[model samples]
Target: MLVFILNAGSSSLKYQLMNPIIKKVFASGICERIGIDGVLKHEYSEDKELKLDIAMPTHKEAIEAVLSTLTSGEGKVIDSINDIEAIGHRAVHGGEEFSASILVNDRVIETMKKLIPLAPLHNPANILGMEICQELMPGKPNVAVFDTAFHQTMPDYAYMYALPYDQYTKHGIRKYGFHGTSHFFVSNEARQMLDRKHNTRIIVCHLGNGSSVSAVHDGKCIDTSMGLTPVQGLMMGTRSGDVGAGALQYMMHQENMTIEEALDIMNKKSGILGISGKSSDLREVLEGMQNGDERCRLAVDMVAYNIKKYVGSYVAALDGVDALCFTGGIGENAALIREKVCAGLDAMGLVLDPVKNNKRSKVARDIATNGSASRIFVIPTNEEYVIANDTFKVVTESR
Candidate 1:
């Protein structure tokens, strides 16, 4: 079946057209800077890449452009849009109503609207994409695979805050971790690579511009670092990870700053970028570290330290963890960070083979030393595939 998966942002639309039955990505690309000078980049697996300069004033325009690309002779992956069996979307938040992917319907659309306050930056955009597709493909089936759904399994104790109980019950104000889709995909893939069953305990580290760690026990999320919002986890490229609750109040009082002002600092001007006073990109941090920049070295060390601390915390949460899997841009590509994080884990019976760890961009492989009790792996995440699979399941099951 031809499944088109979309991940819509405030000003961008990334899409993948895939024949899920054959597991082949026919065409994939993104439209960037919508409502401004736009860029359309499309790629076909047959070594064909197209870059177009166009005016995509809205997501509707972007969708129309994408449809044109699919039917065009230059990059035609299929005969017509009718060949698309279904459309899947990466909905960033589902509030408390959706626990899994669901076929798009009027009720789903309404629920998505109600979720806007919970995800002001994402849900509105997602709704826009959905509405555009509904107009463009009248009766076509569309699915919303939420990023928050996979984390719904978190128990009350794990997701709750110390705030007044009524706040949570009234406003749905509990932890709803982000990147659930990526964490879910990588955890499942890691289990398969380990030749183990779903019930095995695993810690999936999803590190990138945005990052989080999940503890999967019995194939369900037991705990995750992110809470209520994406800004609560391990230090991200721009977001300050976890911080003392009192700091916000103190900063506001001392500087006469508003909550929004403090939030702007926490969300945009923090993490490695804030500490290093350099670039947020890991590659740039590494370069500065190699050039003997103490601040850059400190930034790198801090990120690694935060990851290791989470690993230890997950171990305790699970009582004992079976595997530690790394996935995402930094997790899959940063060998230096991996080496540093695994340095003192030997006390926890987790050891890495330096030789194996040194190999860059290797696929899922065991990197643990001979005598380690736990295994460590590097598994790249495929959230798009997860959305596709969920979309296929929902559509087919309904039929």
Candidate 2:
């Protein structure tokens, strides 16, 4: 079956057309600047790419342009929209309502609407994409693949915050981890690479602009670093992670700022950006560090240190880890970051081979010393494939 996977942001839409069984993406592209001047980049194959600047005043127009590009005569990927058997959407926050991918229906849409407060930055766009797809393709199956679903397996103790019981029960405020889809994909890939049984314990560090760590036991998430929101875990591109509540209150009072203004600072003006007073991109930070910038050096050190701290804590939580997997943008490409994270982890049985760590490859490969007890691997993540596969399964089972 051909699955069209979509990840819709507030102003952009990323799409991939793929067949889950063959693990092949027939076409992929992104629509950028949906509300203003728009650009649609369509890549049908490795050598064939088309960039078009068009007017996309809304998501519906963006979707229409994408469909036109896919079916256009000169560079067509499909003859008709009918070629797409199902649509898979990436929903950021499922809360506790969705534990797995499910077919989208009226009830699902309503529930997702009710969840808008939980994912103010994501769910509305996701719902808009789904609603547009339903209008354009009336009878085709649409599936919701949530980013929070995989972390739903986390134990209550691990997910609950230290807030009052009434706050949790009445306000639905608790640690709901993000990046669950990426963690799930990478951990399963690690299991395949290690040839391990179902119960193999693995700690997956998904490092990117947005980062999180998960301890997977027997293919289920036991604990994760991200809590309540994506901003609670690792220091990210622009987010201040794990700031003390008292500090926040003091800052708000000192600046005579409201709660929303303080939160805006924490969410958008902090992390590496606030520390280094530089670009949020890790590449830029690394370049600055190499040029003897103290703040950049400190930023890099802090990121690695934060990741290493989480690794140690997760190791203790899991009792012992069988394999440690690294994924996401920073995890897969930033060898220096990986090396720094594993530098002092020798006592935890993770010994990184410097030579292997330096040699980067697209495929999964171990970077651990030959005799290390905990094998270390670098596995790239494929969230689109996971969404497509889940969509196919849900659609097929429903039929």
Candidate 3:
């Protein structure tokens, strides 16, 4: 079955056409800068990059352009829209409404509309993309694979906040962790790679520009780093991460800043950028550190320290963790980050093997020292594939 997976954002849409039954990806691409002069980048397995500068004035235009690319004769992936069996979408927030991936129906669409306020920045884009897909491919089945769905397994205590009970009950105010898809994918992958049982105690770190860590106890998400919003947890590329509530009030009083302005400062102008007064990219931070930049070094240390602290906390949360699995851009590729994060973890019986750590293998492999009680692994994440698989299951099972 050919599944078209979409991850639509406010200004961009990413798509992948894959035949999962046969393990083949025919084409994948992204459309950038919607609602203005935009760029469409499409790449087929055997062809050079296809770049087009056009006016993608709306999500509808973006979808139309993607359809055109898929059907075009010049190294196109599919012969016709009929070849696309189903569509899978990456919906960032499902709130407390969706516990698992669901088939897109009128009710699902309605639920998504109701969830707009909770995920103001994501749900609308997700709904718009879903609407366009339905409009263009009238009868095809589409599945909504939520980023928050996998985290539904979290216990009440883990997801609740310190706010008043009435406030939480009146308004949906609590932690709804993001990156559930990546965490779910990587944890399962780690278990499979280790030949362990499905129920394994593991911590899956999805460390990227937007990062989070999930503590999976026996294949269920007992806890995670991101909370309420993506702005919580570890310091990210641009997000400030866990700041005290008092600081916000203090800043407001000192600067006469509105809540919105304060949010913008915390979410966009902070994290590595806030601390180093430099670029938010980890590579750049590492480069500056190598060049004897103290601020950059401090930024790197802060991130590693935060992650290390989370690891220690999660170890206590799970009592004793079986393994630690790293995924996402920085987790999978950056040996230095991994090394630093695990530097002092020897007390916990987790030590990195320098040789294995330096190899840079893309596949899942253990990088822990011989005598360590806990295993360490680097697993590449395939969130889109997870979405597509869920799409296939939901679509076929429904029929």
Candidate 4:
């Protein structure tokens, strides 16, 4: 089935028109700066793409532009927009309400609205995209594949914070891990590489600008690095992961800043950017490190150390790991980062082969050597594929 996958951010909307069954992308692009001046970048084929400056004041106009381009211009991939069978919207926070992907309807929309407080930066845009799609293509099937859905299997003890019980009951405050789809996809792929064994312990390190690690036991997520939000786990590009509450409070008092101001710093000014006092992009940090910048080197060490600590804790949580998999942009490309994460874990059965780790490949490949106790792999994540496949399944079954 041809599925349209939509992931709407605050000012950007990304989408892919693809066939879920065949694992083929018909076309894909992103609409940038929705509330400001708009730019539509459409990739119609492997070698051809079009970037046009357009005026899109809202998500509605963005979708319209996408549909118009897809059927009538240089970006055309299909005869008509109607050829797209289903729409899959990436909902960021389900907040304990949805454990699986479901066809979008009034109730699902309302539930997502209630979850906005949990994911203020994500759910609103997601809902806007879904509502706009529904309005544009009336009666068309829309499925919401939530980022939090796959982590719902986490036990209450694993997700609950040690705050007042009423805080959770009345305010819905808890550790709702993000990046569930990526964790689920990569872990399952790692399992398949491990001969489709049962009772397998897999640790997935999804290292990107925003990173997270998950402990998947027997194909289910038992624990993850991210907690409550994307900023709670491993050090990310800008997010200050797992900082002490008292430290933030003390800094706020010293600086006489508002709660929002302090949180903004943690979310947007910390991590590699805050530490190195350099660019947020990891590539830039690496460049500075090679040039003998101590701050940049420190930033690299901090990120690697945080990820290593999380991996160790999750290994204990899963008792023992059978496979350790890396995915996402940084995890897939940064050989130095991967080597640092697994540098001293030979006893834990994660012996990294420098040759295999450095070589680039599009397909899944293992980096652990023959003498290693467990397997270590670099598996590229496919959250869009999961979204498209789920949308196809729900829509097909509904009929």
The reply for model 3, stretches above 4 Å from the true place, is: none
RMSD of each: 1.2, 0.9, 1.1, 0.8
Model 4 over residues 1-399: C-alpha lDDT tens digits?
A: 889999999999999998989999988999999989999999988778999999999989999999998899788889987898899999999988999999999999999999898889999999999999999998889999999888888888898999999999999888888899999899889888998769899999999989999899989988888887788998999999999999999999999999999989999999999999998899999999999999999999999999999999988999998999999999999999999999999988889999999999988999999889999999999999999999999999999
Encode model 2's per-residue lDDT on 1-399: one tens digit a residue. Answer: 999999999999999999999999989999999999999998887679888998999999999898888888555889999999999999999999999999999999999999899889899999999999999989999999999999999999998988899989987899889888888998998888889857688999999888899999988999998887788988988898889999999999999999989989988999988888897888999999999999999999999999989999999998888889999999999999999999988889999999999997999999999989889999999999999999999999999
Candidate 1: global Cα-lDDT? 0.90
Worst 10 residues of 4 by lDDT: 222-231
**Model 2 pairs whose backbones collide:** 175-228, 176-228
The local distance difference test score of model 4 is 0.92
Collision pairs in model 3: 175-228
Error of 3 at 61 (Å): 0.9
Regions more than 4 Å wrong, model 1: none
Global lDDT of model 3? 0.90
TM-scores for the candidates: 0.98, 0.99, 0.98, 0.99
Name every residue pair that clashes in candidate 4.
none
lDDT of 1 by residue, 228-297 (tens): 8889979989899999979889988999999989999998999989988998898899999999999999
